[model samples]
Target: MKITSLCILAIGLAGSARLLPSQPQDEQAKSSATVEGVFVDQDGAPLEGVHVLNRIWPGAESSTESDGDGHFEILLEWDGNKDGTWYEGYARKEGRAMLKFRADLRAGQEFDFGRLTLTPGGVLSGEVLDASGAPLSGAMLLVVDAAQQASAPEGAQADGPPWEQVIDRGSTDASGAYEIIGVPPGTWFIVAKHESTWWLWSEPIRLEAGKRATASPFHLESLPAEYQIQGRVVDPGDKPVANAQVATSVLSPDGRFMMQTTARTDESGQFVLFFSRLPSGTVDLRVQPEGDELDDGSLLDVSPGARDLVVHLGGTKVLRLHVVDDTGRPVERYGWGLSIDKPGSFVMTGSAPAFHEGGYATLRVPEHPFELEIRSDAHDRKEIGAFTPDALPKVLEITLTSSQAISGYVTFQGRPVPDVFVELVQRTPNYLDGVVEGHWNGLYYGLESSTTHTDQSGRFRIPNDFPHITYYARAWADGYAEGTSGPVKVGATGVHVELGVGGEIAGVVSVPRGLPPGGIELEFYREEIKASSINTSVGKILRTITDDDGSYSQPHLDPGTWLVRVHPSGTLLSDLGWSEAKVEAESHPYVVTVQDQDTTYFDIALGRDEPCILEGRISVGDKIREGYSELLLEGPFALDLDFSGVDEHGRFRLVARSSGKYRLVINAGPGHHQYKTITDLVELVPGTNAWERDLPVDQWTGEGIRLDAH
Candidate 1:
């Protein structure tokens, strides 16, 4: 009867299944399944040598290739159990979007998809030329889709997509012609980047299936000549400071310091600083020599031409500090920082002191009134302030108290949840609060100290060496909702936390006709209140992709009001591109109220595309800057959409996509002074959107933006 059941299971699995001969009944039972399929192109022609991947079945050869006749087979081995098992298959060729399929399988099941179709790929070709109309050789060309563009990291090469996101890439030949073959059918952005010139991009281009798209010739703009700052570094005795570090800073038009290039002095104590994108006008330049007592920084004018200069570090003040524990023993491995006392000055200079002997370290700074702070890994931080170096002791003594340990256990539904990760976050003053004073202080709390995991018994212990700080504990585990503990002082006794059973939200994302050709992602956001105020912060964003059938489920979501929406892959309009207003009108989000240990089902039907409008004002300081702001909208895949300038009323309007996050960069130049501000993660809704915001003056200080500077 068992042998008959195995044969029946194999035959019932699928019509295309192939059952192998039965194994010896005396031996341990061995069961296997076979899946057979054929690959063909859209026009019904067999696709030879296509690669088919089997991702659904584990413990098997992952891939196989179609034969000349486009026929392929996959063998899957299964354990004795046959309940609730499934398999997935994917087929692909170079330069094509993968074709996906899925099916259910049992221990002795054999399934055949019969024949699968593959979509054809496209091609992009173009030529690159210099500004003078001469063919530019050795230039790189990149093709990218919308998803790759939107998720690219900041400061990534603007000339082309990042290496990992490049769908197709090619280098210009002697004739400046480049061809990228096997580009999948989609809307793509093409860019040409030269080694010595600025990048040139094409407007969005659509490539149709099995067709070649010829793009317009790209003209590369010449880059400005390299600005050089050549100078020599010397000590107070006018002796060459060989191998000394030379640093420079450029001042912005708003009178803020911006750190620039750095170079180490050669044997001759001479260094040359090069700037590929040097700003114009006078720049504040500072030079510091390695292990020297001198401060040599000044203002210098920069231009396209190279110039010679010299810097001399005069006498500087050296302050020594000694760190020790409560036992009066020298403590090694400590960090210290210094802050100067001046209006609009929020620079905090830090150093990793090498406690070679007696826990003593030295620091060189300008002669001024300064506040000092010191901290260690295993101790509480210490701070001392308002002391002038002229009246200081030779070695300042600083003490640190030993850290404490906190132990705890995690439970869900009265049962221990092992392998739970607990995070200890320190709570500090909300710097954004209006009541907070000081430029850089009082905005946020210090960094989190340590993380520990619970054992099989749900027990966890923070190391005894953790710093003493007021913190709260948050615990989370796979397939479970997160839980938070109240603020606990590290010096207190053991803590306990209880997590609620996680719930699941399952749904299907479908387009008007059917599922999108490619994969789609669903974004889940939970609204949380900031501090103890009513201001809301978008918290705990969870993202998951849909399967081939456009079905998705996210389990272990904490009990709360969650806003769930579909984000279509690529530059599709109905997905992330919808505006908030349009989404509300169209009921785009599937708002679900989750309960502990329960499941909720919701289905979403994407809406039609609608025109989007964005209008906003640019304010500089307290006054609106009319007709001065230049805004650039950067969309998914780094598509640069240049818009018109601001009107005389300091207001600007733009037509954009319905949904998706954008980066807005406002550049304005009052006289020869240029100021720029960037606001990232700007969400756009359908219909009309209005914004009135201030454009803070861009700061260029080497330390960071001055907290007091506007």
Candidate 2:
């Protein structure tokens, strides 16, 4: 059976099913079942010389690897079992480019269904050159395609499709020429980056089948700069500290500091940084070493009201602290942070110190007084006495009592949602990621190690074992409403809570009569709240599906905005006549807003068109391959192609449309694989009923993988 969205959201054990509903015993004696054909590209042309695997039956694999005509097939046993055992179909990773077909059979039954198509992805090749017409060596390039425009249903996401990828990387040869191939046919932007700072970009390029488009010579010019800054680092004994890291983050006019670059201190503890290139402005230089701790201090302003200037750092001292229980045993592990406030001053800076062997680390102010605040995971923060740098680095060890715990269970419509996501947050005046004030920090106590599933009965528990912190719990499930609990204060033990059952979205896909000829696929995606590159379950997709519209219905979708798109089978689009009409409702793409207890309905209609044919041919080393071509049009733009062809005697003609700047993509069989495209736009007038182009299939000399595993 094919993987489903429900399986993805059902947690672990329940996802192991490899087959759908089975067939009856009498059907098990069938002599054979028909297999589907595979094509290359979005176009329905034959794909020759490829592997195929059967998931349900062990040792049942087939290899036809197409002939020069891109056509082949295999036989399989599909008779039903007495106990109604079902037959499952699937292709192994190596055969992913090919499609699998299932069979309904009985004893002595014979299946003869034929014709399956597979489309191989297209490729793009080009060179990066310098001002003097020489290839640029070691130039880092980034390619971004224009295909990031689709909106998927909630929880399902596509990793920037084939048309988009970081497709190539290599240094130029001494001859000053470079070639980056193996890119999917589409519109792409090429950016040549120099080091991490200096760089340049080329205008967007488009690629077509069997052609090479040359780009005008590109150049990289350095940005102008002005002014400079310097600084130094030292240890508590006033000795120069080498190898310390120092950085400068200039603030924007909007008061936000951009990310800074790090530089190391020299053997003399001194450092110099050129601030040219950067617009004239006030910049903050922060210095620190990986292993060294600093005593409480303030930024020393060198020039008041000046946008640019120099500054120096004095030596720093370290302080050590230990927090434990009344029994005098050291505190094992917990979150710890500190705050420094000088005498007669309202200013204070909070910091989280690194924990070592017997205690925690902090900065000690020599001959000065400062206060300290200590906090732990799930525990309330505590303030300690002020001390000067003259004081000993080690402070007295002590203990703090534990806090209360809170727990909860969440369900939807009387059923426990196993994969429900939960979070505990505290809204307070706090510092996070070195920033003084921001909305709820993306931190959840015990989240990483905690079990995030509800039992069969829909029961869940969150143990809050800490020392005086307060929190609120929030839970969410896809396709259902989300719920949150009131704030709970934990003084000594945990508190219990339960959430109400939420609403669900259920509806069958009712298609219009005379449905178009094509297999359809669906995908989903959720909305994001905040910007973050780090990995966390929060804001990430919970599930997705490549198929829908059967008796089964997916559940547990949280209330929010959802989008759904219909991707018709590449086969029908390539072989049959289908009007290229965008999917929309009321003249605009459908927009759905889901809420608690809300249920919605949606039905789709497919468009049709008059039949047309296009022709093309290719060649590679005394071999010729011929096949059909397909073109997908969008508004005034027609992009993307899928065609399978073969090469024998060095020539071959495929058929399709004869108009628009189509993303012409073609592939050859096992003999000699030759694939290439033209990024430069091309125009083909309609009513001609024909188009012809010649291509070359390069022979394999035992080279590495030409295309990445999609």
Candidate 3:
């Protein structure tokens, strides 16, 4: 992932390579039988009543019923689905009865059949405590599975192991004690969150079948200490003053300051303020009195306590301005604005020119360095660098110039484009890679605006009034293609140009044609230039699910080399929380090229993965705890799969791409503490899921505080 210091920073993840090894043909020749058993949760010690089926049986279909012993009988049937010559593998039948299933099942007739014994699933329990050690009511705990990491949402993404599962949910109890039951037996990751900002994440834990896990006490810290500022407001003669409003603010290291408290001075000329929370760094103090003008200022180190200080008043600084035309001749009465640069921040002052017979007016500050910016209606602007203290007291000077404009017409597919927002994107070098950055509202050194919504005839004008020494522009319209132009020098007038829209691409996405038709999702990617080369993913072109018709499209594209791919929305499902039916593209690779005048059409096929089903439970001491719990997983030693689970009888099953080593973690819902590192590395082979784990039992058992199940 790459990180940069922008207004809003974002990063992308690197793709993982496919690594499950292939099975031998000789292994497929052996006769196999089905081994069936009962799923008894350790906490409840009861049988799971729901029928678990392997539909499209590449694997044999089996049924089980619990006897008086709490163990069930396994009955088997022969292969229900056959693989044709062109097919590579079969679907593994597994999923909740109501939700969707996307995995294929492998043939089960090759393995040896025997009396399969199923053990009770595991449990995770713990207490949520505040800074004072008292239970904190209303906290939340979350669990994430480790194997399906690629597809989970934002907060849950970091909790899962490298690539197993990703899910988030949890809530706390009235006493802050939480028990996450019904977790699968495996490695899981857990987290506890309070008040949205304060949180705690546990190291990965593993729970084996029939065992319960207890977590070390998890405590939420108190809010950070606050600081108090008090000062007096007085005139230049040092006399006591009354009713002067004073304000406090702290600068953030990344270039911003949040206002704290604003209060007025009392009859004693003194004002007292208590900041809610002091920011963790250097701070600046600002004081402004209401009514008749009196200037006062002070700077101090503000820590976590009441601070007393004194501020003195003085004459304000006078500012002078002049508006000039492109010819350098003075112009009268123009719209204008002013701004200032303070440490870690900036503020826009009064708009409209400060006018007087002498072209001057007075302003005041705490006697420090500041940058002054002045702008006018004619599109001209001027900036004066750092102004420290002037030895001789005087007024500041500002001069601006008039600007020129560019006019032109635009059309898409030979028709005038109207009611569309036309953006004038200027190309600028990105320090990290050299390629032009993405378009944004126009600014001089940054993106600056020109004009928008051309008139009925598709003719418009862009006034060259911003600070850029030079500019290049691009025009864009939603649902229609965008066009770009070569660089145009700033300050030049009467430049003319025309824009044209390109053709579109569309096609159907489906699974390999020979198999029984099933649902799948498809996504599109558009290759773009970045850095000095084109080796990275610049942006996503089009993202749409295949309809029952399996059709998709690249609504717009610049004629160029194109690469298309289809995959089960495994990645997108985990990333964006998208539902299955909406994504129709295949989960395989495809390619196509679009020419300037060609409306390209094509088709793509996809491949699917086998499924593995897991079952487990959560417990505290000797009792069953009810509530939501999540499952988190990690690989051989790496964080990967991150998934979640909710408990009634404490059981859960999840899907995966391919299997390898995995870890498991479990957590309780909101206002609760969580248990972690309860399970260790377990192997997941295709067509088999005899996997079992127990979350360590948390011992909260005592005389009248027992947890009761309804």
| C-alpha lDDT of all candidate models, in order | 0.58, 0.40, 0.44
Could you give the candidate ranking by TM-score, starting with the highest? 1, 3, 2
Mind giving the per-residue lDDT tens digits that candidate 1 earns over 609-667?
Answer: 56456777755553334333322233212223335476545577655534655545444
Question: What does the lDDT come to for candidate 2?
Answer: 0.40
Kindly report which residue stretches of model 1 are placed more than 4 angstroms away from their true locations once superposed.
1-230, 234-268, 271-285, 288-348, 351-379, 382-409, 412-473, 487-492, 515-518, 528-539, 571-588, 608-710
Estimate, for each residue in 160-207, the C-alpha lDDT of model 2 and write its tens digit: 123234443323334433343333456655555332224554556775
- State which candidate has the highest TM-score: 1
Per-residue lDDT for 1-710 in model 3, tens only? 00000011111221111111111101222322333333333243434342333332332333333454344333344322221111111111111111112232123321111122233445566777876788876566666664433332333221223222333234557777765544456766666655422456565667565566666666766443344566687777887678865665644333444444555689878976644345676555556555324544445564445455676654334334444555555544333333444444454444343223333333443233555555543345667666654642444445654446555566776667664444444433322121112311121121324544565776655556454655654565666555655467655443333444456577765544343222343444433222223221212234455565566666666554344555443222322323453232122224455667568887654444444334555444433333332222331112123354646444555433346544333433223343221232345655556544332454332221111110
After superposition, which runs of candidate 3 have C-alpha atoms over 4 Å from their true positions? Answer: 1-300, 304-406, 412-415, 419-457, 461-472, 491-501, 513-540, 543-545, 553-557, 570-591, 607-710
Candidate with better TM-score, 2 vs 3: 3
TM-score of 2: 0.35
Candidate 1: worst-modelled 10 consecutive residues by lDDT: 1-10
Q: How many clashing residue pairs appear in each of the predictions shown?
A: 18, 88, 108
Per-prediction TM-score: 0.38, 0.35, 0.37
Decreasing lDDT order of the candidates: 1, 3, 2
Residue 258 lDDT, candidate 1, scale 0-100: 46
